[model samples]
Each structure stands twice: as structure tokens, then as C-alpha cells.
Target: MTPPSDPARIPGDAPDESELGRIAADLGLDIGAQHLAEYRLLIKQGLGGYSRLDELTSPPPTARHYDRDPGYLPGPDENPYHGWAWRCSIKGAPHGPLAGRRVAVKDNISVAGVPMLNGSPIMRGFIPHEDATVVTRLLNAGAEIVGKTAVPAFCADAAGLTGLEPQPSNPYDPTRLPGASSSGNAVVIVSGQADLAVGGDQGGSIRLPAAWSGCVGLKPTYGLVPYTGAFPLERTLDHVGPMAATVADCAAMLEVMAGADGLDPRQQLDLAIGSYTDMLEEDLRGLRVGVLREGFGIPGVSEPDVDAAVLAAAGTLARGGAEVMEVSVPLHSDGLSIWSAIVFQGATELVTRGDAIGANWNGHFDLDLVDFYRRAKPAHPAEFSPTVVFTVLFGTYLTEQCGHRYYVKAQNVARELGRQYAAALETVDVLLLPTAGMKATQRRTDGSIAQIVARALGNMHNTAPFDATGNPALSLPCGFSDGLPIGLMLVGRRYDDETVLRVGHAYEQLRGPLAVQPPKLADRR
Candidate 1:
């Protein structure tokens, strides 16, 4: 909590040689007794102002939405398939666009007075004192914050099966992964438990689950929705979006969710956001849909059925008066490598520095978060899932051996990739591809670390790039592959989320409603 460059204001008693020796050693300093005394004097003086940070307090909420005190309930196990962090019934405004809509908030996003597990055992008892921007917006719009849903540890898994609770099962088929990190968001919606869900996407968390769950998910342009209070992974890549059973519902949510809060530094002052639901139209007349020429060339990566379904979706749009064409942006193929260097390297820096880059953008942050990480991380490293452990290790290694130069290079190249996409967009309204090249992979009960990591990393090739390039991308059910839902990915230019949603709505009209319903919903209804 200490300010980065505050000068020492007062002196404290010098530490003893033994204490100094241990502290120095912990920092990789090997000071002998001879030099320890002088170092201790200097260190004690330098730390004199450290107590100033303790006087600071956590930020208070701007508004309270719960109609009644949110009492803690036993983790309800009504349906074992419905995995939630906690269950509570609460309502918001009596009349608004989302009134009467039941919604599930992802664990990583804060809800005032609620325990924010972030899908990690280490964060079990941590409670956020304020709501995330999205939560406040949703509450103001009259949506009930029904419960907190499950997520993979820190929302790190590519497959939805590893975290603090049982991974939310696929409503369609329990044997398959529902989707990555935002797994519960998709599952709860598909199961009829909630009408809409809030989800955050670093790579493909939002879309992956929507695809696998036979629903709609939108990862708006990187900063369109302020991430003022969400726990961050990589600041530049983090996105909070909506997931629902229909494109119109996703649009209605986005109408309230998007806009400049003047808090998230990621948001552009000149960015234009409008009523998204108003943009949804039944016809896509004269719109051009570009099929990325190189998106499906990877042999082992692209499954035949998945590819065919996306192409068929493109054809469906073509039949509905949209011009469909193939356009090549060769740099698209390099997305994974570039995304890896930036995300891993950036992630290492975020965790190691004990601070987030944009934490103060809103003039408030969960200072307890830093303290919690400080106390829990070293003490409970085992609490992280294998995928998160791998990411941390890989990131730490990259920072140590390669230094941050590679991260800088990756960021630089990412700008160029964005330009390439921008150029391609000038020729087409949106780019079409499979949200992921493959369909939902099988869920394993207890797999080896390698298998878990592989499962988490399997479906990121197509989606991760848009996260890096800051483009608006939406995934909606186009059809099913071997009975599992397949998603057609529609990507629009940065800040052009309305176009992407419009195209998706148009496509849905052409394809009609997808009939693949998860069996789990039958019993509940």
C-alpha cells in the first residue's frame, strides 16, 4: 500500500543483526555481520514511512442494492451439477430493463459484502467491501444478483473443470467441459437457474463456455465496459462481458454494461457506445462477412465438424443477404505466440509486484487484496490449480531469463496485429470463424497436470487474438457438432461491438432458434 516514491519521514529503532540477516537473505542479499549493522540502520530509516499506508482504509461502496441483509447460507447442493460459491436471494430496483431477471455473478467480480473466492482456496474468506462496476450497473438496471458462480482458479483454466468447487457440468452433457473459466456463467443460464450471467474473459473464457453451453456470450472491445473493481489478470487483456441464452438478451445487458466510467484507464474518452439492443436487426443486407482464410488450416487444431458448422453459419448469413468472402490476415496465425509472451510475462509482473497497474484508476481498490495475496500466496502456493501454477512458473521463468524485453516486443507486435485486423475490417464488416477451432473437450475426473494444462490450452488459437487486439467478438450457437454446441465467432473492429451483435442477431434470424437443449433444463421446468 506504500506509495511508490514517498520519501522517508522519520526514523525507527534499528533492527538486530539476526533480524536484518533474515530479512536481507529473504531478498537474496548476503550481508555479513560486519555490514549488517550499517544496512539495518539505513533500512530502518528507509522503512520509517511504511506505517503511513496502514492508516489508509478500503474504499466504501457508492450505493447498496440488496433489499435485505445478505445472510450467509450453507453452500446449497440442490443440484450437484449447479456449482455455486454461495447461494443468497436478493433483489434490486423494482422496475427497470432487467427487473425480474435472475442473474449470477462470476466469483472474480465483486459484490458488496459477498465472499470473493476468485475460484481459489486462498481467497476463501476474503470479502469485497464494494461492488464491481458491472455489479452496480446490473443492480441499477433491476437485475437480481442471485448468487456467485464457480470459476477456475483465478479464472485461469481453458477447460472449466478445475478450481475451488466442482467444475460446473455441461447442461447438455455432464461428461464434457461446459466452457473455460466462465464455465458457471454458461451452465447456470443453460440450466434455467438464471436468465443472464456476468463473465470476465482474459483469453476466451466468455465465448468458450457460451459455445459449449449452446448460448450467447460477448467479449466487448477490451475497455468498452469498465473493469474498475474486477480482480485483474492482465490489465490490457481483461474484459468483462455478458452471457445469455439469446443474442437480444446479451445486447440488453450490454446496453447497461458498456460506457466510459472515467475510472478504468483502459476506456477511451472519445469512445462511442450506443444502445446495443437497438442495433439488432433481422436482415444483414449488404453486410460483408469475411472468413479468415488461415483460421482453419492447423491440422490437429481444427476439428472437421466445428469448421464445417462455422462455414455453414457463414453460408446462412450469405443466404440472408450478407456478402461472404475469405480474407487473409497472415498475422492472425501468430496470435498465440504473441499473446503468450505478453500475458505470461505481464501476469508474472502483476503478481510479483504486489500491485496492479490500473488499481487506482477509479480512486478505490480492495487494498485487502494486496495484503491477502501477501499473506496467502507464499503460505499456500499449493492452493492454486495446476494450470495457474504452470502459468506462474512459466511467467516467472520468462521474466528471470528473458527479462521484460520479450514482453515489450510482444506488445509491439500486437499493435501491428491489431493494424492487420483493422485493415481486414475495412474490407469486411466482421470476420467469421469458429469461436474455437474444436468443440468442447471431454471432462476428466482426475487428470495429470500435463493433461489439465493441455485441456485448458486446447481451444485458444482463434479467440485469444481478439483479446490482444482489443476487438469486439461474439460467439453464438450456430449449430451442433456431434450433439455438442458449436459457436460461430463474429469479430468486429475495435469499439464496433454493435456491429458484431447485429451480425449475430441477423445470423440467428436466418438459422432460426437452435434446438439443442441441455437435458438438465427439462427436470427443472
Candidate 2:
């Protein structure tokens, strides 16, 4: 499908510091301005923020759903981003139950008339003939798809620095990148642009963005939500999940997103989940919850706030009558590497699916994965960001060369990790851990290599293994650092989402609701 069309854009090549500063100023993004300056200095000093850059780019949205974001009025004069987006303020409107409940969707998933822009420009203009199984479920549940979110070309890197869709800037500090492919969705959710959003997770696509943006993200038991109609990242690992302001909200959305669908081969995965929303009230008491003390974690960045918040949240569960124990997974290193291979495997698939050159997809991005989608498309080699294109090109070769072997190894790692995780459940019905080591970072126009490692790897540090084990997992904001949300992951045994949901909801209520709101458009406010 063709990526959506939009008018905003950054030049194809990486912009200089001065240029980045100018862009930030125009948009009133202070954080971005600072990062651009710091980035310039670092480049001169031979330093790098590859991870930061990677986080900035990512699962480039298939189309810029919000680039030309439509404005709305609740009382004759209001901006969409300003008031209606805030959950607490608008939670009880005409949309009542979900009245005014605005949501954004990742382009990888089907949304009927909406196009699935999986980050490659090749599919431009290709709109889905029907709503993805998940979307139809959402409509029946009362939520609305306000816009489609951007991604990093494919569901490849969660940092979503794919630089497509005029990448959504972090609201708190525009300099920092909103962890993505579901980048904009998470940002809008946190910044009060949307109440909840539909996001897909292959590695950390959903959770990382949620953690980074201080929202709640969930990847239900694999088959709980059908994969039919959603673009593939890795058939085995891809999930259509929910991103929301709170755990209860996610549970509500999950209620509708899950059901049997004959069209999906994976539909065989639909187990009998009685009531996802009902599962929310399950007690945390007598729940065996585990804490990850060693191995399998986001590396490089040292985020004190993230660590402190996650620990505090875990302690909160203990205070709530749950027995939280410490645990570790086997072959953590091997497991992570194997997952990395999986990322390359899926991304290469998305990139190679087409032969088109640069073409516009979302509101602000024209992603062409044939070469490199980040940055503006260069007329030739000189215009390309060497590292970005090289990563994709080399990744294509690597997936082709080592993917099968890695797949076997990853399967083993999945087995080993699952066994250990399952054993941990003996003492704790659920396991808790930091979703990512840090909050969101600055978004950049440069190819963000480290962001990939931080996001894809950091998130999977505690996640992926579950995908391997076919178990269920959930992430909720336990607390915040500097007001930005941090996630507390709840991992459960295979097909045990019910237990996880109960514990998650109990803990989420204790944490209360998020209190952030988007700014009223200048004069309107």
C-alpha cells in the first residue's frame, strides 16, 4: 500500500546542527534543539549517539496519519492535541464509555480504509480492503482510530528513527525521541494526544515505546489477537497489541482485539480468554511475582530513574500481598543475539518486498526501503547516510546467511528462557521487571544505530523470551521519572494472561491514573 501523503519534511541528508535547531525552534521543540547542538559537538569530538539516533528514527509509520493532523472542537473552539486527547479530562464525554476516546494505529496493522504503510514506499496507495481483525474488534468496543502511527520502515527497530512521518517528537523534551515504530502513537498517548493507540510488537516495538513514553503497552498471549491482515515482521513473533494511558484501558482494548478469526492461519492461537476486561479485577494476592535481578536487560544507558521506578513499582506489588521473588533466565546472551537475528530476518523481508525508489507514505515521510528510508532520499550515494543504508544492506545479507541457524538457536533460547521463567512462576505467578533502562531520548535525523540496540535489545532483554515460550506478558506504568512514564512488566506462564491481568490491574489502580495533558494550541488555550 502506498504510504499516506503529507506536506512536512526534513531534507534527505542529515541536517547540520544549525538546521536542526531551526526546525526545533519553528515547532517549539526545545529538547530537539539542544540535542542537535550536542550532536554537532559530539560529531566534531568523534563521539556518537547512535543509540539516541536509532531511538529517534524507527518503525517509520506506513503513512503520516497525524502529520496533517485534523483539529477538533469539543465546545466550538478547541485543538485536538490540546484538550480532547487527555484521558482524565475527556474520559466522560459524548463518546462516554469511550466517548472522545481517540486512538492512533500503527500502519502495519489493517484499519479498513487506512493503508498499511509498513515503512517501505513500495506499498504506497495500497489501502486494506477490510479492517484488520484487531481493528474491527476495536470498533465494536467503542474506541476510534484517530490516525495511523509511523514505524521504522518495518517493525524492525522500535526506536523508529526510520526518520519517516516527520518523526513525532517527545512532548516533554522535543529533543528526545519517542521510542517507536509506534512512536507517534506512544507520544500522543502520553502527551494527551490520544487516550490509547493500537500498536504492534515484534521485539520492543510496543513496550519500548510505552516505556519510553510512560504509557501502558501489552502484547497478549500470541493468538489472543489475530495476526490476519497485519503486515508481517516475523510471522512467529509479530503481535497486534494495545498502547494506552493505563492498564485498565489496555485491558479494555484487549477485550475487543482478541477473538477467533477464521481468516488468520495463526487464528488457531485463539484460546478461550473468558473476558479480558473481567480479568482486570483479578486479585494480586497469592500471585507469585518474580523480579529480574540479573541478566537479560537493556544495556549501555544508565538510567537511575528507570531502575528506581521499576524497583519501587515491584515493591508496590509486594505491598499489595503478592510474593515477589528474584529470578534469572538461562543463556540470556545467546537468547538476545538470536532475537537480534530475528529482527534482521523480518526487516530484510520488509525491505526486499518491493523495488520502488523514494516515494511518500505518511504525512511527513516518503519511506523507500529499497535503499534506505531514513533521511531524505539522496539522488545518489552521496545523499545517503552510509551507516543507515549499510545496516539495512548488510542486515539483508546477514539474515539470508545466518537466519536459519539463528532461528534454530533462537528457538532453543526461547525454550531455555521459558523453562526458567516458568520455574520462577512456581514462587511467583507473575514476574516484574523494568521495561527499558531509560525513558525516551532525543529524536534525530541521523541513522540511529544505538537506538536499535537499546530498543530492540533493551526491551527484549525482559520480553522476547516469552514470545519464544509462547507465554503472555503485560507492561504498565508503575511510576515516573521526571514525569515521563516508566513501565513495570508482568510476565506470566503460557496462556496465563488472566493471572497477569489481575495483578496488573490491581497494581495499576494503586498507581492511579496519568495526569499529563497536551497543550492548547496557542491562542485557543
Judged by lDDT, which candidate is best? 1
Tens-place lDDT digits, model 2, residues 411-461: 666777667777777777877777766676655444465544444344456
Note the Cα lDDT for every prediction shown: 0.82, 0.60
| lDDT tens readout by residue for model 1, 1-525 | 222222233345667889888998877787778998888777777675665664665456556666744646334445456556766666878889999898888889888888888888777667777788888898889998878888888888777867765668887788888887888888888887788999999899999989888889999998899887788888889999999988899999999899888777778867688889887974788899999987875668998888898999889899989999999999999998898888887776775454444333443455656666656666566677887778889988877787788899999999999999999999999999988888888887456888888888778899898889999999999899688999889999988888999999988888886767675543231
RMSD values for the candidates in order, in angstroms, are 4.1, 15.4
Show model 1 residue runs off by greater than 4 Å: 1-43, 56-59, 69-77, 352-363, 520-525
In angstroms, the error of model 2 at 401 is: 4.8
Q: Supply candidate 1's per-residue lDDT for 259.
A: 89
Off by over 4 Å in 2: 1-100, 295-299, 346-392, 399-403, 444-460, 513-525
